[model samples]
Target: MFRVVTPKNDQEFEKYFAFRWQYLRQPWNFPPGSEKDEYEQVAEHRMIVNSEGEVVACGRVHMNTAEEAQIRHIAVHSAYHRRGLGQMMLGALEAVARDQGAIRAVTNSREISIPFFSSCGFVIEREAPTELGLLKRQQMVKKLTDLSSLVLHPKWCTELQKTWSETIPITEHMGIKLHQYTGKTLETRASLNKNINVHGTMFAGSIFSLATLTGWGMIFLQLKEKQLEGDIVLGDGDIHYHKPITMRPRAKCNIESLSGKFSILESNKKCKITLQVNILDDDTPVAEFKGVYWILPGKEASDAKRT
Candidate 1:
């Protein structure tokens, strides 16, 4: 297995920079230190290492503004091509940008690498200056705060968002929106300004509500994907607040944290599933919510049962 990590010591950094220089600069006849820049001291750097401790990929990200980040020096060894090391390194770098409160990320991609960056949710915004005044590049941009590009079932996610806004008017007022649903994970976000308390942070009740809706949306998406129908309701729930969220609040629910089966709903009128949702401020989890959801037969299923 390949693990993504930061350079924690001199030896690890040596390997990381060497790999970056070898893959990104050596072929271009660039100087030995041309692989790095002035941002090295402030940027977040990540390297993908194989099980044997060999660095195979490396990348860096640095904040350009409070809401923008620049990604640089993305390089993966030729032997690691098609193995997803590049994507893994990019993801780690993006996470660092998000953790630093960046809402968007930009990268300069060589012509040959444009497709790879596009596949990872970046779009060409404009032409970028040639690298070392020789290699042509394109400027690509992606919204890190809005994960809609990662949605596997965009139609279902949109339907769920519409249903929430129309059925629960409060959600609209809370600025709740479904951000992403990748079949296995659901992410939802709420505006802090819309849900903030007098203490200048997100209200506890709003946090709980965000988590509840996130978990509910996960079950909704799962059932929809499986061609099942249900009336999802929160049966029980508890929240543990670890910190106050001063920024926008986001809730994430993963399938791995869910327990129970949806197939049971086909045989019986009801099924129960427990799931966990984490509320995050930036990249730090500020609160955790555990909820038990009861899925009862939907109108069509109930009509069939009655018949």
Candidate 2:
């Protein structure tokens, strides 16, 4: 549970000002009592608080007619700095700007804060003055276009969730029904090996299959959502049993990040994509598999998509 706060009253707004005084002004030795000015009247201030009811981070934005705005007074308590609360607050400000019809959001960042802004996908535009005597502040902005990639239509995500739930148990029972199990990319499992004396280790085959399945699931779902249909298949795969696995298995696929190449199938044609699977023990990767998938096309893929 997380809450993004925008101070709408005198007390919270003053707390907003105090945050800069405590984290920025006091440490940087800025001109006394001049750290914050009359901007609170027109600016939209945001804060994030912990469950203990203490404000841990704050930021302010002056909405200058939706299309453009300036962000200011960003600060986080020393104890809570690295937890990304400040970044989260900035995200909220960007949302508000969008709600106000802004197609882009901008910020003026201090030198120390430039890397942080860059990591968040902002581009530097110009330099400006700061309270600490002509500090070369950087101006940056990010267009709201990327926002569209995030909207999931809810129904599609829910369907994907259901597919994951259904597939896990089926894959776990794979060898029980068919001696040959298949998968997509990275996978990790515990004690799928017949050699129990190996101290609870998983078999390479099982781990490989699980990873392939996971990647196949993601690609299958994503393509289906786009109205793209195919028989997504694992034509060939390789496994590298890195070290040993002694815990219950978990797995993942890496199509989203890997560049490589893949193809889509239609009708009865065969199209393929390579899937890399990683098997892990309690979140630490232990074994791996690379799976080559062939899209079988038509009914098989479409039926799976519907399910």
Candidate 3:
């Protein structure tokens, strides 16, 4: 629900405190700087915005030592409290720590906040101090452990099984799961009649999503064969229709050219490739497609104990 943390530069520092009086020094009447400690300069501040572009929540973090990190000054606007904004903020901070080689992450929670952090996978070890006068805090921690095997990379057979398991509306939707890749070639027959015509042809939108997904299936096949671990997401695309299908439509794709479109990926973190699938009616070309799709990098881990 929130974007990545952006460290505030000269242009963005003034927006941190929203109703600092209500959240920080409201009840006990503590001094102004008690809530905001010395971490502002060195630590990273992440802000969350609602659709209206108002900053509703904010968090600050700093690397405490060589092997540990700490989170400080995590606050959400009163109207937005109890929404798990704090938990999400910590999760984002934890990811930053993990990527930076931290072995452990810690946070000191106010008395009312101990239960919240505990539910976010932290364990309290002892009581500590707080900015508000005469308040006892809880010492909480979340350990950083190896997460390599939590990902699952599926194969041809495994993918088909997954598709079946996740498919829906068994009575209305029909799928022919191919056993393996057959060189980007797919031939499916669809009933067509003159009554299906707007301009004496099949509806264009039906052919669009179908043929686009046909090329998508081809990439799915190649990824299955390569055993490369990643998720395929459609970043963007463009489609062009060439002719009309007045009769049955047979479809085929040339993945070699499509594969060449991805050659740029070897040096880049992401790639966008255009694919063409010719829709033919009994050997007569009815429509042609020029579709572009964005491919992002993704990896997921499976459950360790369950597997």
Counting clashing residue pairs in each candidate, in order, gives 0, 21, 5
Which tens-of-lDDT digit does each residue in 174-262 have in candidate 2? Answer: 43111111111212233354323355666556666566766666566556545766656667777777776675465644333233333
In order of lDDT, best first, we have 1, 2, 3
Q: Give the lowest summed-lDDT range of ten residues in model 3.
A: 146-155
- Report the poorest 10 consecutive residues by lDDT, candidate 1: 145-154
Which one is best on lDDT? 1
Comparing 2 and 3 by TM-score, which wins?
A: 2
Could you tell me how far off, in angstroms, the CA of residue 233 lies in candidate 1 after the best superposition?
0.7
- Of 1 and 2, the candidate ranking higher by TM-score: 1
Top candidate by TM-score = 1
lDDT over C-alpha atoms for residue 76 of model 2:
79
Candidate 1 C-alpha lDDT tens digits along 1-307: 4555678789988898898889889999998899888899988888876659888888999999999999999988888787656666676687678778988999999999999989888999999999888999999999986646446567888899999998878899999998655465577889999998889999899998899989989999988988988888889999999999997688877665789988988886688999998788855568889999989886644764577
Task: Please give, for residues 1-307, the per-residue lDDT of candidate 3 as tens digits.
Answer: 2222353565444455543334755567775555566666787667665546566777767898978888766677878776556655565566556656778878888888888777656788777675555776788887766331111232553554455336422211323232222333333334455225567777676566546655666666655555443345555556666777786555545443363344444443456666666565644556666666655543222222134
Alpha-carbon RMSD, candidate 3: 20.0
Looking at candidate 2, what is the lDDT of residue 63? 71
The model with the greater lDDT, 1 or 2, is 1
| Local distance difference test, candidate 3 | 0.56
How well does model 1 score by local distance difference test? 0.83
